[model samples]
Target: MDQEKPKSSALSEKSGVEQPEIVSKIAAGHIVALRNKNVAAADLISGILSGNITALSRAITLVESTNPEHLAKANEVINGCLPHANQSIRIGITGVPGVGKSTFIEAFGKHLTGIGKKVAVLAVDPSSTISHGSILGDKTRMEELVKDQNAFIRPSPSGETLGGVARKTRETITLCEAFGFDTIVIETVGVGQSETAVHSMVDFFLLLKISGAGDELQGIKRGIMEMADAIVINKADGDNIKKARLAKTEFNRALHLFPAKKSGWTPKVSTCSAITKDGIDEVWEMISEFLELTKSNHYFGEKRREQNQYWMLETIDERLKNHFYNDKNTIALLEQNKKAVQNNEISPFAAAQILLENYFKFNH
Candidate 1:
């Protein structure tokens, strides 16, 4: 045996057995189906109206897509869903980082669902400037609310828009309303221009703040304070309770300095412990009172009408900007002009004018 070593097996030799044709056929069929599965706009509308979460998610994804092919279908779905929308309360929540926004929203959303209301939370996650990706971890943070059948949580990335609010958030709200969700909660990425954007789209705006973080009055943006329908002081537990109350008082005083809101309702300040779930009910009560007052005074409807008009104009501006910036010639010229301006070969205004003239010549 040693002398006559067995013939070495060749590594390149093919096996005698072959894979079944049926298996390959099935896989090919699946691939074909997947490749051809373009959901119709009417189907998406019907599914959304029937409260299908999967369809709603797909429709929202379509709305958020930047692909030129999706625009028409997205618009069709949105138009179909429009008639069923504007029936839910749109609440926008914003806070600085570490303000317990996710925790508070989880508790508040659960409370809404517990009271027989279908709740939809559209939480905007901040995108990384380097990678242009978002963590999208709200579902993981709101463990309980994510598990609730009556509650829907959709986390969207805040793209390169002026505010950190998602560009398609308003459209997402419409789809949620058509899905039979009576309560819509929008959580902004963080405090900034985001508050203004979210405030315009929501029926009520709540600003969350933590106690003992810094001077309550110092570094606070007057615009945010004025835009808030309520300022909620979070983490109001343990040794922080007294500090939270003081902050609330300060906010209430600051709110008084601003002129009365057009809504004819005064902004309220409250403190709540997201950990202990303390004062969460009172927060809802405050919002309820606001809704009652606004509806009775007809400010609610008027505000919504004004918002619709604002969004229409904003859409036009956004489209024009996109068209100009996305053109190949414009992109090339912009880079050249940028370099020229940086090198002092041309003035900034002159570079801008050249780029604008070129863009208009091609576009017009």
Candidate 2:
């Protein structure tokens, strides 16, 4: 073959002519359009109600933003979308660290999507104090689910919220529901008061347990067990199957001793293997039965109404707290009062009363 002629480079030394001018121009136009696009609250609401995932994600980000303007817009978006929500099943999943929460969620989420159900997972990851940033590593853990087109996974920071949940988790759930996800799963930080906080927001609370030494159950608190609608023992395959079954029995006995739920639905216990994907359908079936019973008895709507009222009050309390604490004068007064109390110059009650009086005086 003849020797190949010298090929010209995209950047020609003869002249400053760009070879990919058209492609570069088109890319620049796209960047300009994206930068200039202003999404309005009404558009966000409409898009969310129409099952637009991008719009839903944007709305959720607004809700999580600490900026005052974003919060106002987020509230507007939420209010507009409220009428179109409440169709999804909100499930809260919690367990101790190493209980395989991510693995279980991956398996469960994939199963739901396989059956043609849209799934949204709101994962709350632990926050790092030094960086004030979240690990947000759940996406890495749930590799398969991350690839599922029908599934949406969002990992939020726990921040200073004692419950191991993002402050705007309920708002995120609302957006997910409006986006037409039929199943919304919230995975909380596996420690602290997360179970109770999750319990208040979700329709069904599923506690994941694993068989360990005789003290396997000791890690979980009694209040959390009482709040669980269903407790599922995980890692039930192979040699662990027998232990999981025994744990299931013990949990069942424990649940029976609690007072009956207001929904008149008794809690149940089951065994599952996220690795083997066994008994996952049975767990979902149990949830469906509970839903049917609650719906028939009208407790389903009743519980939602209660949750709304609870959240409304919570919002008001949080607003008041933020208002008080964000005031510069309030901070100065608090510091002064704290020092006085520490120095034995004033009683804690007196210091608190003075600060409250000052706070109200300025705020009012």
> What TM-scores do the predictions have?
0.89, 0.87
Poorest stretch of ten by lDDT in candidate 2: 14-23
**Pairs clashing within candidate 1:** none
lDDT of each: 0.91, 0.88
Off by over 4 Å in 2: 1-38, 213-221, 341-345
Give the alpha carbon lDDT tens digit for every residue of 258-325 in model 2. Answer: 88999999999999999999989898999999999999999999999999999899889888888888
The top-ranked prediction according to lDDT is 1
Please provide, for model 1 over 297-348, each residue's C-alpha lDDT reduced to its tens digit, 9 standing for 90 to 100. Answer: 9999999999999999999999998888998889999999999999999999
Measured on C-alpha atoms, candidate 2 has an lDDT of 0.88
Clashes of each: 0, 0
